[model samples]
Target: MQNNPKIVLLNGYGPISINNELLELYPVTTSHGAIGFPLKSLRAENVTIVTNLINFWSLTKKMKPENMCYLYAYGGLEDEDMEKIKATSIKST
Candidate 1:
């Protein structure tokens, strides 16, 4: 299709839009499902996702910096989990 794909997804609020183009829109089988494998496989420069909270957290925990993310989820992530993930995630690289 000439128009960009209309991605129906669960999350990726901040990783999908870099230079105004959507590089990828990863799907989630469920709220807690991971997107790392799918995202990495796409080799995307940017991504936008609309999913549940758990999907956002899990994918954010593993995304690469070059692959910017834009994730949107209802309700915010738990403070403790986000803290731990931010400290431990290698996404900065």
Candidate 2:
């Protein structure tokens, strides 16, 4: 295990896909909240991911568990702020 397992908690909706290039380098998963998303794999390096939140409420139940984090925006933050959230640090996530 990593000294500090990092989980990229990105909140959006719908089915999410990581780039093929990225998936090759890191383990990824699609899940709800920060509990069961892929966290250990993210510690390998710094990565930014895009996810869809279109129907998250209904979809989350169907999602399998992984070790990742989930950052929620919910239209409360501006675009730039979201970018900063993604770029700044793992601590923020």
Candidate 3:
């Protein structure tokens, strides 16, 4: 939990948003973990995580309800971004 990415809310998406400005200041790596698809874009008020990390999804589901957060399958990072992350990690799977 100490290293998890903090979740924040936006009243709505707007350019020059304070939240976007703030997020840009910090470093985000895939090591922080995939959250999910954009919920607001999906029109869901709660967090929904659309993750392909099946084992992780099942494990978390047993521990907690599927709140609005998404574990999006191949979410967030683009192909180039994913490549960069893979470059940094040791081959575990």
Off by over 4 Å in 1: 1-45, 73-93
How many angstroms is residue 30 displaced in model 1 relative to the true structure, after the best TM-score fit? Answer: 25
Mark the regions of model 3 whose C-alpha exceeds 4 Å error after superposition. 1-40, 48-52, 59-69, 78-93
Query: lDDT tens string, model 2, 10-66?
Result: 432322333211332113223323322333222212322334444333334554443
The CA lDDT of each predicted structure is 0.36, 0.33, 0.28
What TM-score does candidate 2 get on C-alpha atoms?
0.27
Tell me the alpha-carbon RMSD of every candidate.
14.1, 10.9, 14.5
**TM-score, candidate number 1:** 0.27
Tens digit of per-residue lDDT, candidate 3, span 1-93: 342332222221112113223221111212243222222222222333333356444543243332223324333434433332211111221
| TM-score against native, each model | 0.27, 0.27, 0.23
- Give the count of colliding residue pairs in each prediction: 19, 17, 18
Error of 1 at 68 (Å): 1.5
- Candidate 3 lDDT: 0.28
Give the least accurate 10-residue stretch of model 2, judged by summed lDDT: 19-28
